[model samples]
Target: MLLSDARSIGRVALPLYLSMVAVSLGALVNTAALGRYGTEALAAFAVTTAVYFPATAAVAGAVRGVMPFVAAKADDPPELLRVVRNGTWLAVFVGVPAALAVAGAGVIARAGGVPAATVAQLGPFPLLMAAAMLVGGFGSTATSCLVGLGRSKVVMRAGLAGAASTAVLSPLLVWKLGLNGAGIALCTANLVSCLITVSGLRGRLPGRLGRTIHFGQIRELAKVGIPMAGTVLVKFAVLGVLTVAAARVSTTAVAAHNIATGLAGLTFTAAVAIGQAVVPLVSTRTEGVRRAVIAGLTITVATLAAICAVIVLGGAERLFTDDPEVRAAVAGLLALLVVVVLADGLQAVLGFGLAGLKRTTPSFVIFSGCYGVLAVIAVPAAQHGLTGLWAALAAANLAVAVGQGLAFRRASNL
Candidate 1:
């Protein structure tokens, strides 16, 4: 049973992982393109991205809530079409407000004490990214439905197309129109990807579109989606607080923290892929979540181990920056990340499994209530500086992992 579960997960996870890597690489390409414009440009890009990603994640997560529903009805073509149509409407409902909110990025950045010149250079970036997110939200709905239907190849292909377009367009746009061009490139890629994915869905499903707007289905989606969005928002809040804490330590600490975070994010891609795979399987199959969770943990640990090994053996510090202080700080943070990643990986699988079972509220409440409150306290209370911040983060992740695991066990009666 364990072996069977592992194979089943791998079949979905491998393609998802590749797609995720492509997406991450696309972001890197954008950053690299902006980096060519100098420090202020890079800083502006970073600020906008920090402001933009959480808003998009919230909407995208909510739209992705359609996955389990679609997976449960995978064998029913009409039901899948209805759900997909409703999911698209839900995305628009959530996305418009999100886009409007993110349009205030300049105001937020100014209030956050970003330099006026950088803020000025950041003009239209927020709006451009907001547009991208709106389009990407629709694409997320399509991708989720496809994944739930066990058609991850479509998602993978769309992601690859987006990544390829971003890689080519970002640098060209940045070269032509400066920092704002990156935003344009992003929007272009997102729109292209959305078109491709939606087209794929049409080809696969082969049916007329259902009602464009369905309040009942929208409400049902929101019932599952709101908590899912809350989960993402809580996690983002924790990271934001931690970033603030690290900033207070010093500029060097902030640089180190970012590098470590980037590396940790790469490792987390595997965990997320595993979690995504687990969702559709758990939604369709009965039992085996225990084995699935264990398998996910094993994969996460092994991936992190390889990353840690490379950091130690391959002088991974040079890959990020050349500063000695930053390198030293990143090394210390990576040590703490060994614990953080494990906890996060465990929680992800359990959380997604519970999400599959439509038992997301418990996971949301426990994560936000426990991790959120502790992270708020731990960041400010950590007297030992950056180490204290890392400790706080690790503790928060551990609490959530344990809490979510217990919650899932009780909910599942396993």
Candidate 2:
């Protein structure tokens, strides 16, 4: 029965998995090109990308919470639109301030002690990244509505379109125009992607003045989003410390680290997609089927991780970059990272499993400790060097997987 159900789960998960893989691979392509450029460019992206991640990830998660909830009400467009409309307002309320804050931070960092060249690249990049994220936020909510209605294929198509644009644009921008151009390309690519994704939804785009703001849902999104945002913020803290640590080591070290991280991220995306796809199904399934849902998800994540491990272990140098020393370092990191990646997959599965059960708050609490506290501690302590960074990451991933797995088991018991 579990095997049969797993097949069903795989059928739904495959497209989403492929989409994530494509996106991750595109990032790898971007990273490889950037790694070739030299340390300053790499460090600049590392800091900026870390800064951008939380904003995008939070908005994405908030929209994600809507999928299963909205799915159940597929027959009710008015209700769905109302909910989506609420989400859009939240995007503006939250996103605008976030854009300004990041851009402002870049300005302040320039004033503080950062090099002039780094400062020049930093200021405009955050605004572009933020604008991309804000537009992407709306797209995320719209995509959730479509997914809830069983239109995941539409989501897949839109994502592929976006990834295609990014894949083509990133290198061209970097090669021709330098760092600012790269940032501009990223923003443009994401904006195009969001537009394509949102167009897949059934509802009309609310005009800039369609409905007065719904203070209630705005508050609720903030209530949910703030904690979710906290999770992302904490992640940024860890990345920030790590980036600073890498910079102190040397710009080249930071660049190498970025390539290694990007490669691992590419492999990890398969697991993330499976975990995400698991949520709506698990949410809809009965208690009797919940275990089966989880079982399918775990299997999907494990299988994907194994495949990535084989590929990376086999071709770490070629896949990551051409420099022998950088390759050696990255391969060692990837070797350790495969274990971490496996654990991360499990963690994602368990975290989203909890989310599927309408148990986000507990997942949030667990993640806060796992990701926010323990994971945060590991990175800096890894100041032993690149190897140390891997060790730190491994410990962080293992802890989160075990902790979240225990939480899921307990939650399932109730």
Candidate 3:
């Protein structure tokens, strides 16, 4: 049964995992491209993305509100189409405002307390990020449709397409247009993913796509997704604070933090992919959900530990930057990241496990209450420099791990 559960989990997770890796690879490639551009540009990319990622993630979380329902309707094409149509509409409704927010991320980031110089250097970056955010939000909705229907290979293909675009475009664009070129690369990649996934989703629909949107289905998806978005918002809000703390230390520290985070994010996606797989499994296979979650946890831990070893021992950090100062600055941050990444992976799976049980409300309550209190420590830690700030982030991620893990127990039981 354990093996079967693991296989089931893997069947669902592998494509999802690869897709996330491809997506993350795009960002890392952009980082490498910008790193060669200059330190100031890299620092601006770091801060702009710090805000951009969280905003897009929040919107993605809200779009995920449709997954459990889509899974429930998987056998019924008409109903599934209804669910997904509403979801895409939901994506459009929320995504527009989120893009606007991303467009002004420099000012918002300034308010969030990143160094003003970093913010000032963010010319044309906010607009580019907003463009990526808008396109990516819709792509996330389409990807969720595939995930719910066990069509994750389509998602993988879309992600590879996006990553390929990034690989080909980032160098050319950055070489020609610098920072704005990076943003254009990201936006174009998202557009490719959006087109491919939406095309895949179309084949599953029994009839022509709707001309009119339905508010009721949108509300239904929002009901599940909103609190989850809140949970994600709170967690990343702490990350944003940590960015401020790093910014306070020095531009070098903030840039290093972004590099470490990019590395960690690549591994963290494995765990999150497991959680995304868990949602439909737990929602459908009531008895097997427990085994699925356990198997996912095991898979996540082993995968991350291996990734940590490979990154640390194999000299992969050089791939992220050509800058010696940035490389040296990032080395210390990597040690601290080993612990933070594992803790984050644990919390992410548990949070997704909760989502599987359709119990996202507790997730929001726990994250908001826990992270809100713990995030304040980042301010004081900034005074002590990079190590102190990372430790504060570790504490916050650890506390969230515990809170969300405990919530999963109670939620799964109920």
Candidate 4:
């Protein structure tokens, strides 16, 4: 049974992992391009991107919520289209405001302290990135829906196309048009990805050009989506506080933080992809089977975390920086966060499992307590300064994972 479940997870998760890795690299391409332009450009990009994370994550959850629904509707094309179109409408509606909010926030970020010139330079970045990602959101939704339907190949193809385009275009744009030009290039890639995803999804999802978009489905999506939005906001709040604290530590510390975060994000992308695969599977499985499934996923997550720890702790400095102290500090920080990653994997897999069971409210509550509140409280309270921040993250992740794990086990029994 364990072997069977593991095989199933692998079948679903491996392609998802590949796609996520490509997406992470695409982000790196953007970072690399901005870095080549100079520190100011990179700094501007970091601030703006970090600021955008919460909104995007929250809005993106709507799409995440749709995955299992689409997966369950695999045999019913019209149902799939119903979910997809609702997601499309929701993306368009939410994306515009999200862009405006992020743009406004960027303006305030500059007003508050960031540099006048840097702020001016950052002006177009938020909207452009948001717009691009808005398009990417549609593609992501489509891909995720496809994955839910056991169509992982389509997701992988779409992601590879986007990553390839971003890698090629980002540098070219940076060379010709500078940092803002790179943003434009990214937007183009996202639009291309959206097109690819839509094409791939053709004949899979129901509803042709004639079907009117359903307001009721959008409302139903919102019922689930609003809480997820809150969860995203909590995450944003936590990161925002931490980013501010890191900036106060030193500019070098901020840079180190960003590098470590990017590395960690790669791990998370894997977790999310795997967790996404778990959602539909768990939703459809028996309780005993679900427990076994979660166990397998937890082990896989731990293994991946260990691997990430070795790579980052072993040699990330070689790739990311030259400063010995920053290297040491960053390595130690990443090592601590690797434990968090382990816990995060467990939480992620089980969290989505719970969501698949329609038990998302508890998850929202648990995550809020663990990440939102506990994280905020613990990070600043750490005695070791920056290391304290890492400790806080580790504690939060472990706490959340343990809490969720217990809940999942008990719920499965019930």
**Whole-model alpha-carbon lDDT for candidate 1:** 0.82
lDDT of each: 0.82, 0.67, 0.84, 0.72
Tens digit per residue, CA lDDT, model 1, 108-142: 88998988998887777888988988899889888
Q: Write the per-residue lDDT of candidate 4 for residues 1-61, one digit (tens) a residue.
A: 6666766767777787887788778878988888887788788887777656666776677
In model 2, which runs have C-alpha deviations exceeding 4 angstroms? 25-47, 121-126, 167-184, 203-214, 218-225, 242-257, 372-389
Would you list the clashing residue pairs of candidate 4? none
| Per-prediction TM-score | 0.94, 0.82, 0.86, 0.89
Winning candidate number (lDDT): 3
- Residue pairs in collision within model 2: none
Segments of candidate 4 deviating more than 4 angstroms:
123-125, 206-209, 247-256, 286-289, 410-414
Worst 10 residues of 4 by lDDT: 375-384
Which of candidates 1 and 4 is the stronger one according to lDDT?
1
After TM-score superposition, what is the CA distance of residue 36 in candidate 2 from its true location, in Å?
Answer: 8.6
Error of 1 at 179 (Å): 1.8
> Lowest-lDDT window of 10 residues in candidate 2?
201-210
List the candidate 1 regions with Cα displacement exceeding 4 Å. Answer: none
**Best candidate, TM-score:** 1
Candidate 2 versus the native: TM-score? 0.82
* Top-down lDDT ranking: 3, 1, 4, 2
TM-score between candidate 3 and the true structure = 0.86
